[model samples]
Target chain A: MPHLRWARALGASALLAVLLASAACGGGAQPSSGGNSSGLQVIKIATQSPLSGDESVQGIALKNGAALKLKQEYDQFKAMGFDLQLDPQDDKGDPNTGVANAQKLAADSQVLAVVGHLDSGVMIPSEAQYHAAQLPIVSPANTNPNVTSQYKYPEISRICGRDDVQGPVGAIFAKDQLGVKTVFVIDNITAYGTGVANAFKQKAQEIGLQVVGSQSIDKSETDYSNVLTQIQQVKPDLVYYGGLYQGFALMLNQAAVRGIHTKWMGPDGVFSNGLVATAKENAIGVYATSVAAPTNLTPGGQKFIQDYTAEYKENPDPYAIYGYDAMGVVLQGLKDAIQKNGGKLPTRAQVRDAIRAITDYQGALVKVGFDSIGDNIYAGYYVYQITSANASTTGDAKLMAQYNPKGELVSQ
Target chain B: MSSTLQTLPQLVLDGLVVGFVYALIAVGYTMVYGVLKLINFAHGDVFMVGAFVGTEVLRALTAGGRPLSPWALLLAAVVAAAAVTALLGAGIERVAYRPLRQAPTLILLVSAIGVSFLLEDLVRLVESIHLGKFVLPVPTVFATVYRIHVAGLQNPLTIRLNSIVVVVASILMMVGLTLFVGRTRPGKAMRAVAEDRTTAALQGIDVNAIIALTFLVGSGMGGAAGALFATQYTLVTPYMGFDIGIKAFTAAVVGGIGNIPGAFLGGILLGVLEQVGGGFIGTKFQNVVAFAILVLVLVLLPSGLLGERVQEGA
Candidate 1:
């Protein structure tokens, strides 16, 4: 009886967590999805994102970015005797909402591909639904290694770099550019943070940089002084934080208060306007490595910035070019599949296979190429230093260096 | 000296700031349990709501770079949050707990959990609609940092101005509440109700009003704590309350469920122990240390440190 009471209590608390979690998801619109496909053999691109909640800013940008690309490719698809239309779904950033959106997309016979779901946790679970429907989905911003490596869901392909590669890219830059020798690592104890931190640590050691210490902190914890104290005691040359912008910003704020000024670097998770907004001046000189290059860094991406700005009338979030690139990859698959089908509309399976078989397909920011596991073989990482300008503009982080997937220096 | 030993003073100082916050939230739990003999599980969410409201107020006041003293801004935030959360606490008691007063303990617990979830979701929905963000970066109130140079350590023991305010404010609330319960008429009525509801009614005390007042004061304290916590920590989310609430509840239990001073003592002790113990063990085990102390206290002193003053209600 007591155990039952405990079970009921636990269940109640779990329900509470679910309610809170669900309330935080987003949903959005635009002429909306499922529009008339010009009366031709319709090809639908479904987008999943939290279109309406706190994450809507990023999610809507992703959807709009993908939409802009799909809209531009519409005439080409129409000329090929097929109709191209976008179907945007608000996954609301909740797993349940994302899965529901996935199910809806799966049921649409015309829908052949998906372009989003900003959070990795949301997208990873939705993969099954997408895979079951024989619908290939391309991730725009997910950096988790498991995105491609987990189920190796051939239906899932991502245009962004993975967490493992992003971490080592920072280490490579540290040694080559900053001449970093000694380092300390810190993580938020979550899967993403721990994975990135560990990768950075392993790569740092592999490259002969002495790793003086490592520590994990709880993300929910407000006070990080205990860990900061540990960092003070260790006195490493540089500290690498593998966490989101919020936690890293807090650490930077606390470190400044403590007068513990060692060079600090973090993975892509720390690259955001929120970081600059939260930590302000402390964010200056902080090094971060991102899977996606700054939108203006490449010629193709520079064009995307202009087109996207002209289209949306606002500068795109960092995820916009990624969304553009992802949808571009999907459109490429549709083209290959249709051509292989002798200019006829291809089955979803054919399109999926065509996507997987991509050997070299260059997009706006990245050259799209998928290995068997749906990872872009040519995915490159960019290292950025937050400047005073970055504090005002959303994605104005100064590009410091670029690295190949193998951690070899590509550009500086 | 060992590195950790040199780090001890800084760690303790950091822990004490958080400990005071825990004490503030714990007093809410202890007071409610003292009078009503119910856990009021939604108390944490109430604290979270206070934080959001406080942040919003601060944001509004400071909009367009308004020139305002940090202390005045903090006062405005704290006052607004306390007023809003007090009303919420009373409303919750009236709607969620009053009708279920005679229900089984398990049922009351379930209701409490339901109320907790409802508050979290409601705040989330409201925040999303109003501010478009459930996670808010609280405007900084105090930017000054004080560095204390010690004899042995190379790095100064750095303390944030906001942290001192958090400690001082919590102490004021704790002492004020103690004096109220010990020296006032309404406070005596509250004590009488806790002692024996029927007897208190016979003694011409408005038992229901007293119970509601207890919730008002307790929840007000929680709101002030939330505001202080927001300023100290710098960011607040809808679910931030759950973690801190659980910790405060543990502090409440460890300090003696119905005892005020016990909650304060327990909170301070738990905070320091968690930091000190976490230093010895892995940092990941910091939570383990807090809960381990709870388990140890429950096993050795089931009644808690100051002892649950069920009849005392102070």
Candidate 2:
């Protein structure tokens, strides 16, 4: 009878311990329940980026800048009655993975908004899910106009100008600035490449320049000597390329070897300082179009640039500034929306609406303004010229000129 | 009319420069298969490891951004990369293949694929060390050009000093190796082992050492090829070696596996085909053109460019 009583007592105590542990762990409790302990509410913002892959260099830069901005705004957000935490996921710039990552973020309740899917190829597939799930997405680098305009419900937004605007600027420069009468347009045949090239060709024809030849190339194949030779035979005054830095650098070097001295131009995809670093002498006299001004010149962009250099010991690229701006807009939207909705945690729909209604949301890079389609209305473009004696050091190259949205050269 | 004449030679010249690099990488694939009778599928990953080694060596030597003379950096990178890669190659053989010495051909082939995956993941881990937007430094001397005027049309010409260096270095290495294998004490042992492992062991030769040496030499060449590849292409990435590895293997098989000179011949030929094909057709179909040529060569010459059959002791 004594042993039986001891066993019964042990069983009762073990069950009580489990119940106590469960309550302490905060399981089976609602966050919405009236709170007794009030300090700062930490909301999580997550995004998918190409952390490793072909575009990883740009993606990493974006990640670092976004992290810095999130850190800098934490105190400000806390004072505004909330706290911000950044969650980053690596999609490797793959569309399939990007979609899955979006779904994963959708399932997470704490995730208030997102700021990613850098590649337009990835963005096209992932945006619908984020929209359906009511997650606000702000792409830092994707410039494909259709990413926003073509979609009926766009949870996607950006701080950078569209390719539609930048492409025409490049074409106009080739036409009026360089006074090139004949042109040959080439693209790497990606959605971004083709879209930008089509815009450039249309504007070039409209600006009274003859499109004598056009060709398509793949990114994998390195040797462009034959294409350069053929393009040389066509004898165009300028060769316009629509591709990323990898193929662009190879083609430029091969073109120089083949004696195609025609001036080369490309969109933001090929505008990287890395392109000049790889192609060197071949990149001389080449012009490129970009959506963001040099980070050194923007209002809040300079501070981020300085901070990045101080931390990483290297100057930040243009994408870094845009990335910082994207984070700023998302966090700012969340804070203002939360304040407006009865000083309570607003729903994801309220956050999405807040992001779309963002007008003159001040950012380090630019004053971000989103249209109904989630396009940045205040975004502008610029043109850069690359001059390098060698294919390694990029700091030696000069940023020759900046162009506004209307293609007029901005006075220095 | 003069422009047209100038364009062909220019195209051909550019093609040869590009072709030479491919040939150098291809030789490693061909020579290893000659005696082993199996393709070292992980050869490309070996090349990639060599490149990373080169980058590290260059980074160490050029610490504090004190620019050493270009030639000094080049010499250090090439030697260090090759030595490191040779060591890695030998290590791979011991860890992966040596244990499976008596395994079937399919098993060995599967092991090679497994080794390739292992090396790639290892690279991905190492890649995280250099955080964010790392631009590799390349010397201008490699891609510098001297314009040549032909038929009153100024043709911009590039003289790849690196290509000349690659050719000379590969030649010297090959010559030294040929002499070592033909004249040295270990050379005979290696040859004897290649003939019949059972008989060579009976003759008191260490079969393991001979196999390790073969890997060391082949991997050394691969390392040299990788360093030159970076200088020639002016770009290096973790996965860059994979497609190139496939191309090199194709070259080796086309030229008769395990044959040194045959691999060289096959590599240059493959390069020429790629160039001519890309020129005639679009660059988009260059891979198709290279594989098509390989198929055609196999149809015509089943044993490969220089493969020979041997009869057992009469």
Candidate 3:
């Protein structure tokens, strides 16, 4: 009798929970339509990014950037009797999640191109699925050289410059610009983090800067007291963190708490509003080398800033422009492929080839030309010093210097 | 080796505060396991809920334009988090556990996991809808950094005032719960229920009420820990609880499941070991070291460091 009573109660509560969860899920689910012979041939450009974790600010903006592009071009495509849809997939910034999302997106025949994977670590692994599906992905932010150089997957390409170049840019900037002689490096213990850190270390050693020590931090963990103490002990001229913005923010704050105020620098992964907001006053004077060029400085970029702010009611993250450029590359490829195929929806291979074939194609922000291995020939890197707490939000950090894709300094 | 020795104090100091938090959440796991013989897998999600609640309260207060003192803001966050999470824990018990009170252990375990998942998704849903972003960064309150110059250390040992607040708050909660369970009448009744449920019921003690009381107290402590954790660590996400929860659960097990003081000991031990090991080996291996220490403890002392104490008290 007691058992039955409890069972009935359990069933009722479980049902209520199911209903609530389903409603919540329903709110997030997009209407995924099948590829049918409708008036407008449907095409989905998927974005793989960490839409929900620590990196969500950058990832979401990356997704939004691509989505905004798709939205804008939707009318143009529709006029040409083609449907352009943005499929934003939450990778959660996990390799497994990204791979799973890639698998799902890859299986969908309608998904011809992708514009994402903010983390190179996520991008590297997920590229296999996209390659198998012949789906071309134009990365908005992944900078690890291995992302394109190692894999050499024509399906994989990024609008952002590689970490090898970005790393040295920071090293050169540190030695030449900031006048820091000794450097201590730390990574987020991620593929992207470790890769960038190694590159920076290599360049630091080559440039005759003292490489005191290096520490690897798990990106998920919050506490950085141990590393902070270590940093204090070594007394580096500058502390370079090759990690995401969130980890860099914590370390910067933690280091500040300990009076360990060596100059702080990071790769583009640390270029976001979250860092400034979280680190607050601690973030000021910290430098981050971004794979993105200054967007507000360009006229078209100004319009993009206005349009994106008006559309999303949020200022685009630093990588948002990268996402716009990535999607721009993909959309260009899609258009070329469609035209090549006589105004018909091209096969996935056609899109992949067309994307890899891009040369001198200018997006709203960056000019893109994919090398044979899908490395953007015209990718430019910029160093920005956080002059204000809201620098990342406005992408208005003081542009310290610019670098070509080859790590050659282009301007002061 | 000298360098490692040099950073030992910093490592231990860093570990202690987090260990106290682990102990706080561990007590929730231990208490529920003691009373109901259930792991209460949802406890971690409960902790996450508390973090969100605390963060939201701070956000609300900050946005209200009247800036309160740091301590006051912290107290508000902790108290609000405790209250909300206490209710959530009780509600979870009522809806999820009470219904399956007579079910098999595996069934109860399943229900616990289901509740855990449901709570995470629910929080995620609520946060996503409300904030349009589920990763809620905790607003700053206590930003004062205290530097202690220890003899033989080149760099002064830096301690965050917030971390000290967390440790003091955790200790206070721990002591309060310890006293409540050891001295109070309801506490004795709960212990009796843990000892023998049928006998406790026959002795004029409401067994269900005692169990629910246990959940409320334990969950309140966990929520307070969550609030403290959010304050010390500026980021709070829906999935944040899973890793910390596992570590806390490990702390409970190492402390000897169902043992209160053991959870404390286990938490501190695990935290120190993790940080020290991580400091030497690598920070990436902190979890590995913590769990390795747990396995070593379990293998050497199967019942746990304070398993003997578990039988003496709930």
Candidate 4:
């Protein structure tokens, strides 16, 4: 009994230590007011993303994009008499962690604006804290419609199209372009996946495509042969999956093994090089829709891709350009605020207002401007097909068609 | 066949294939519990380590588009994973568990959980340093070369060659394990130690050696399961072991903890129930059904279907 008591004490103490350490890390705010004698004040632009765990590949790409943009503008900003710094935080793709990161960023007085919280689930919970702190936040990747819905957090904005807009595009494309009459829809049961899949299913039914079967799969599940078997029975012409890359890869690989060769389509969640790498040859012919056009399409996009590749020595992922543009929006807002305030350091509130007032700003990915509710007015979705399944190349996702916010497919 | 009947064969096949993998991993949990009365929570991470080892080996052998047979690559992967994980299991026991063998059960369990986290983070750190990322795709040596379709089914009921290989290899391993436990001297010593460590030691059996051997065998099976799992899934991540480990542990409990045959039966039952229930009911409730079965089994039959009643204070 005494030994048991001692063991319990040790375990409890160890757990308490871990909790305390994490709390200290999450809640600590460094004093940022120690200015250099040269009268230049340090201002931080924090970026939040999952820098660890399964989705770190996408998050790291986002971080690299922001860091590259800051590097390019660091000296130019310094020349304008402001010491600019980028403080990147890892939210681990978790809502709790994202909230903690938001609190930490909000506590820092010098942090003017934020660049991310890539996932919508993370953004949904954490945006309120930033709103309360009056810190303007822009996301390059968050696509859930409710993230910037009317009457919600007006301080939050994203360059990406909402899932409600993007999901219907996939359904319409499958119905019109691919000519698939019947489809099986699957979701991973997460908030984002469920929302996207529901939108797709609703649109498919509305457009007269038979919704043969719909199923929810746990994201942790690697095997889906049983569900695939059920799908084969329905004999759907196409399968629409609403989940991230890992689940998509697993389902695609397992479906291939089961010889269920129906055409596969997914939303922006599956638009990543990681999917092709994981799914390999099975990824061939799979279709996905994204919130931004390909980096090779426009001249600005082409230059951004070339510079990003040369700097990072790797091709940028789909969300990388969004990260670059998100940072650009913040920097442009800061410049505008400074110019309006006669070369003095503007307050956080002024920066937030400046970001909201911006119009007709050109980004590397698109001509970006925020409308009411902080949503990108020009943001739309594009359809892509995996032409090749090579891991080394830029995912080999060739752009097949583009769809505007109205769900009309446009020829480039 | 009607649509309802058409799905039956495919569901059963799917369940059985996954069941075999779970059964293999569950054996490790059951065997370790049998000897030490301690749950090696790190067993799952050992399985993950096996998967990574298998992936690295296959990648190295097949680099530069080398032409190697699929069977050969699979064999090499399984063997390498098993060998490495066997060493890792023994090392974990020596460093983390053996020191606290005389300690309270709480201490042993806590140590196990600590080791589990340590191993997972350790793998993540090492992989990040070496491969620049924690998640890596396992290269498949052989595609799904053959598909078996059942006749008389209106909707095609197809099974891949990899599924057949997984099932057959699992059966062979189970049979070999049964023979080893039944006939071999070391295996008999292991059983004796499990029955009563003090008495087995007094009767001249090497208690420590038998315990070590139990860990080696159990961890080796876990490694083999991991290798097979990677081959089927075609992706490996540092966190993959946790979910599967919990499921397999649940399988061990449902079948009657500390019973090898019970673990096997429990795994198959859980797998079949999950697949069939998910197919019929809602897929969101698949995990719920599996855990509900565990609870019902524990409540109704405390000793499990095949497990013996535990003699308190034996």
Taking all chains together, each candidate's TM-score versus the true structure is: 0.89, 0.83, 0.94, 0.92
DockQ of 2: 0.24
The per-candidate TM-score of the B chain, in the order shown, comes to: 0.96, 0.89, 0.97, 0.95
TM-score of the second chain, cand. 2:
0.89
**What TM-score does candidate 3 reach?**
0.94
- Put down candidate 2 lDDT per residue, A1-412, tens digits, no spaces: 7787678668857865875575344321222333424566767787677777667666776877777778777778767667567777778777889899889999988788988866787888887888889888888888887888778475778877778877888888777678789988888877778888889999999988999877778765555666777687788998889877778888887666555678888888876656766776677778888887766765577788778788667667557777788888888888778888977888888888888888898787788888778877777777777766443334344565666655566752
Task: Report, to 2 decimal places, the DockQ of model 1.
Answer: 0.54
Off by over 4 Å in 3: A1-38, A391-395, B309-314
In model 2 chain B, which range of ten residues has the least summed lDDT? B132-141
Clashing pairs in 1: A25-A92, A26-A50, A26-A51, A26-A52, A26-A53, A26-A92, A27-A51, A27-A52
DockQ of each: 0.54, 0.24, 0.66, 0.48
Clashing pairs in 3: none
Q: Which consecutive 10 residues in model 3 chain A have the weakest lDDT in total?
A: A27-36
For candidate 1, lDDT tens digit of each residue in B1-314? 38878888888888899899899999999889888888888999889988988999999999979688999999999999999999989988887787678887668788899889888878877787786567788888888999888898877888899989989988988889989999999988988887788899999999889999999999988988898899988888888888889999999999998888999998898888888877767677888987897899888998898884344323
Question: How many clashes in each candidate?
Answer: 8, 3, 0, 0
Q: What is the lDDT of residue B216 in candidate 2?
A: 87
3 against 4, candidate with superior TM-score:
3
Residue range A1-412, candidate 3, lDDT tens digits: 9798879778988987887877656434344355645777888888888877788889888887887787788778887788777787889889999999999998888889898898888888888898888889888788898898877887888777888889989999999998998999999989899999999999999999999889888888788877776777789999999999888888887777778868999998988888887888888888999888788889979999999999888788887888887888899999999999998889999999998898888888899898888888888889999877664463348899998878888899
Between prediction 1 and prediction 4, which has the larger DockQ? 1
Two-chain complex of model 4, DockQ on C-alpha atoms against the true structure: 0.48
Judged by lDDT relative to the true structure, which candidate is superior, 2 or 3? 3
Candidate 2 chain A — worst ten consecutive residues by lDDT sum?
Answer: A27-36
- Point out the higher-scoring one by TM-score: 1 or 3: 3
Q: Please give fnat for model 2.
A: 0.47
